[model samples]
Every structure is written in structure tokens, then in C-alpha cells.
Target chain A: MTGTSFIFWIVALLTVGSAAGVVFSKNLIYSAIALLFSLLGVAGLYVFLWADFIAVTQILIYVGGILVLIIFGIMLTHRITNVQLSHSSIQRGVGGVIVLVIFAGLSAMILNAPWHRSPAIEPLETVREIGRMLMINYLLPFEVASILLLAALMGAALLSRKTD
Target chain B: MVDLNTYLIIGAILFSLGMFGVITRRNGVAVLMGVELILNAANVNFVAFARFGGMDLTGHVFSLFVIILAAAEAAVALAIILNIFNNLGTVNIDEANQLKQ
Candidate 1:
């Protein structure tokens, strides 16, 4: 195995393991911490894919912004230190079976699909290109996304305000 | 060189794990975390495809938009969850069934 493949395996394992921790941990705080690791691992994977711009954005937006928001949400709404939020399973047997079946199907489809692979694997400098495209080709969507974020901010602030 | 299948399989597993978490966990925040996992899984697929299948930057742009959407969705969802906690005194979805009555 080459060095890139080895790095891929390490990052993938870290991501999946931490994601499992996020899922199975009974404590909400522990889950949030695990989610931090998982998001970091994903950022690492994005680097592996040569998406430096997206990798930085992933770290900036996800790790910096969303994870902090989630942690704050956990802290603000409940008893922080003493709260042992039980991750009670509603239908464990059924859920496990359904998940396994969906995974099997997805894996089968992915493996069987004839994906077109490009032979030339040149290291791409994507940051400038992504920025240019966002302003040029994707200008409409970019503007729309900003509007959506603004709306979401207002809605969230409105919803979480204390009502007397 | 790591094959494309490797990334695809990883995405599939992550999606499945997210699905399991969403189905089984009762806590509203945990379920939201699961939904984030699912979104990450889709982002992985999009980036991997853009890297391997075509040299286009469309998938990368799409993933960026998805990340923004996930952030917005998380904010709104968490705010709603907090509202539920305030009104219902709990974040369990099964117990927060005022509409079912």
C-alpha cells in the first residue's frame, strides 16, 4: 500500500470510530466531543481528496461554528454537569435489521456500479477556482444561500427567545 | 492508490450508522447529531465523486452548499429542540407527542 492509501485508512477509521461514539454514547456531552473528532477526521479526508478549500471550510464552518452551536445548545437547555441523557433505544432489533439491509444494498450498488475513473491524477489547486465559480457560475445559488442563512438566523433567534 | 469504491463504501457505512442512530435514539439532540452524520456522508460521496469520476468542481460546490444548509438546519433544529425542552421539560421525541392527542 502507498502512503496515501495508508493515510486514507487511518483517517477513515478515525472518522467511523468517532462517528460510532457519537451514535452510541449515552452522555450527550460525550457524543458532542466524539462529533468533534468525527468532524476533524472528515476534514482530514477532505484534504486527502485534494479539496483544500473545502477542507478549510469544513474545519471553519463545521468545527468552528456548528459544533460550538451544538455544544451551546446542550449547555443552555438543560442541567449541564449532572444531566445523564439516556440514549434509550426504541426499536433496537428492528432498527439494526433495517440499517444492515440498507447498508448491504448501498454497498452492493456502489461496488457494482461502473464508475468512470479518470486516469490523470494531477494535484489540483481548487481554492481559486472554487471561489471564481461561486461568484460566476454559481452566483445565484450563492446569493440564495446567504439569504437562507439570514432567514435561519432570524428564525432561530425568534424561536429560542425567552417568553414571559 | 485508494480506489473510489473505498470512499463510497465509507459513505455508505456512515449513512447506515446515521440511520441507525436516528431510528433508535430518543433524545432530539442525538437524533439531530445523527442527521448531521448523514449529511456528512453525502458530502463525502459528493467530494469523492468530483475527485474520481469527473474533474468538474460542481460536486465540490454542491458539498459547500450542503454544509451551509446543514449549519442552518442545525441551528433551527436545535432552537426548536430548546423550545420543546422549555415547554415539555424533556427532549424525548416519543414523549413530546402533543399533536397525537
Candidate 2:
């Protein structure tokens, strides 16, 4: 096996295993911690896909920003004085069965689809092209996303206020 | 790394795991984590297609938008969860069923 494929396998295992830890861990804190590594692994995958900007964004927004928010949510809501903040689960038997079936179908479709393969051109840099597209083709959506983010910021502050 | 199907299959596994977490976890926060997992899975697929299908960075742009939306969604969802916990006294989603009669 090539070194690239070997690295992919290692990263994939870390991602999938950490994801499992997030879902299966009884301790909420442990799950949150595991989510950190899982997000990092995904960023590594993004690098392999030649999306360095996206990979950096993923790490910045997900690990740095959102993960902190999640941990804060976990800590603020639950009193530390109480018994450990291990969470509970319900209907695992049914959920697992359904997820299994869905995964099987997705795998089959992905493998069987006759995807068109073009002669791959190794684009050395994608950020400039992506930035240009965002300005020209995606100008409207870019503006809209900024607006949405502004609204979300205000809404979160409003909703999480100390006073009613 | 080279095979698109491998990345897609990894995404499928992630999506399935996230779905299972969504359906089974009692804590609202845990449910949100599951949702994040699902979103990551989709982003992986998007980037993979962009690379393998010769989509000329369009997939990267779309994934950026998705990331923005996800950030917004997480903020709103977490705020709502906090509200639920404050008014209802718990983050356990199952117990917040006031409409269940």
C-alpha cells in the first residue's frame, strides 16, 4: 500500500473511532472531548482532498469555535455538584438497525454508481479560484450568509439572556 | 485517499453513526453533537465530489456555505437547548415533552 493510502486508513480509523466514542460514551464530557479528535480527523481528510482552505476553516470553526460552545453548553446547564453528567440512551436496538440499513444502502449506491471520471488536473491552489467564485458567481449567497450569521448572533444573545 | 468511493463510504459510516446518536441520545446536547456529525459527513462528500468529479472548486464553495449555515444552526440550536433547560429544568429532551398530554 502507498504511504498516502496508509495515512488515509489511519486518519479514517481515528475519525470513525472517535465518532463512535462521541455516540457511545456514557459521559457527556468524554463525548465532547472525543468530538474534538473526530473533527480534527475530518480536517485531515480535507487536506487529502486538496481543500486546504476548507480544512483550515473546518478546524477553525468546528474545533476552535463550535466545540468550545458545546463544552460550555454542557458545563453551564448541568450542575457539577450533581452526580456525574453521564447521559442516557433510549431505543438503541431500533436506532442501530435503522442506521445499519441506511449505511448499507448508501455504500451500495456509492460503489455501484458509474461516476464520470475526468482526467484529473492537479490544481496547485484553490483558494484564489474559490475566492473569485465567491465574489462573482456566489456574491449573493455570500452576502446572505453574513446576514444569517448576524441574525444568529443576535438571536443567541437574546435567547440566552439572564433576564426573561 | 485516491478513491472517491472510500471517502464517500467513510461519510456514510459517519452519517449512520450520527443518525443512531440522534435517535438514541437523551440529552439535547448529545443530539446536537449527532447533528454536527451528520453535517461533517455531508461536507466530506461535497469535498470528495469536488475533487474527483472535476467540479472546479464549486464543491469547496458550497461546502463553505454549508459550514456557515452549520455555524448558524448550532448557535440557534444551542440557545434553544439552553432555553429548554432553563424553563424545563433539564436538558434531557425526552422529559421536555409538555405537548405529549
Candidate 3:
């Protein structure tokens, strides 16, 4: 196997394993910490796909911002050490069966689909291209996203405020 | 080199796992985490297709939007979870069934 393929295997394993931990771990804090590693692994996958800009954004927005928010949520709502924040499964057996079937079906479909393949290009510096596209073809959505973020921020502040 | 099929397969597994988490877990926060996993799985597909299908920056742009939307959704969802906790005294979805009875 080539070095690239080896690296891909390693990264994919880390990503999937940590993601499983995020779902299966008993403690909420452990799940959140697992999510941190999972996000980091996804960022590494983005790099493999030559999306350095998106990778950085993934780390920044997910690990740096959202994870902190989740931790804060845990702290504010539950006892720091004594509370058992593990989630109980309601219909775990059925859920597992369904999940396995879906995974099988999706794997079959992906493997069988006649996906069009183009010649692989060398990874280019995409940050500049992304910035240009944001200002040009995607200008409207760009502005809309900023507006959405602003609205969400204000709405969250409003929702979580202490009511007198 | 790893094939596109490999990446696609990984995405599928992640998406299914996330779906399972959403279906079985009772904690509202865990449910939100599951939702985030699902979104990330979709983002993986977007990026993979963009690279292998000869598309330009469309997939990347879509993934960027997905990331922003996930952040916004998480904020709102967490705030809602906090409200639920404050009013109901727990984050378990099964326990917050005031409307069921």
C-alpha cells in the first residue's frame, strides 16, 4: 500500500472509532471528549480531500466553539462530579437492527453505483478560490449566512436568559 | 490511493451510527450530538463528491454552509435543552412528556 492509503486508513479508523465512542460512551463528558477527537479526525480527512480551508473551519467552529458550549451546558445544568449524566437507551435492540440494515443497504448502493470518475488533480491552494467564490457566485448566500448567524446569536441569547 | 468508494463507505457508516444514536439515546444533549454526527457525515459526502466528480467549488461551498448551519442549529438546540432542564429538572427526553398524558 502507498503511504497515502496508509495514512487514510489510520485517520479513518480514528474518526470512526471516536464517533462510535461519542454515541456509545456512558458518560456525557466522555462522549463530548470523544466528539472532540472525532471532529479532529474529520478535519484530517478534509486535509486528505484537499479542503484545507474547510478543515480549519471544522476545527475552529466545532472543536473550539461548539465543544466549549456543550461543556458549559453540562456544567450549568448538572452537578459537576456527583451527577451520573449517562443516557439510557429506550429501544436499543431495535435501533441496532435498523442501523445495521441501513448500513448494509448504503454500502451496497455506494459500491454498486456507477459514479463518474475524473482524473485526480494535484491539491491546489483553495482558500483564495473559496474567498473569490464567496464574493462572486455565492455572494448572496454568503450574506445570508452572516445574517443567519446574527439572528441565531440573538435568539439563543433571548432563549437562555433568566426570566424575572 | 484510497478509492472514493472507501470514503463513501465511511460516510455511510458514520451517518448510520448517528441515526442510531438519535433513535436510542434519551438525553436531549446526546440527541443533539447525534444530529451533529449526521451533519458531519453529509459533509463528508459533499466533499468526497466534489473531489471525485470533477465539480469545482460547489461541494466545498455547500459543506461550508453545512458547517455554519450546524453551529447555528447546535446553539439553538442547546439553548432549548437548557430551557427544558430549567423547567423540567432533567434532560431526559422520555421524562419531558407533559403533553403525552
lDDT of each: 0.89, 0.93, 0.90
Model 3, span B1-101: residue lDDT tens:
58789889989988998998999999888888889899999999999988888878788999999999999998998899999999999989899999989
Candidate 3 at B101: error in angstroms? Answer: 2.2
Better of 2 and 3 by lDDT: 2
lDDT of 1 at B82: 95
Rank by DockQ (best first): 2, 1, 3
Interface RMSD of 1: 1.1
TM-score of each: 0.96, 0.97, 0.97
Clash total of candidate 1: 0
Docking quality of model 3: it rates as: high
Tens-digit lDDT track of model 1 for B4-30: 898898899889989999999998888
Error of 1 at A23 (Å): 1.1
Residue A114 error, candidate 3, Å? 0.6
Per-candidate clash tally: 0, 0, 0
lDDT of 3: 0.90
Q: Per-residue alpha-carbon lDDT of model 3 for A1-164, expressed as tens digits?
A: 88888888999999999999988999988999998998899999999998999999999999998888888887877877767777677899999999999999999999999999897685577888888889999999999999999999999999999898
Cα deviation at A135, candidate 2, in Å, is: 0.3
Clashes of 3: 0
Winner on DockQ between 1 and 3 is: 1
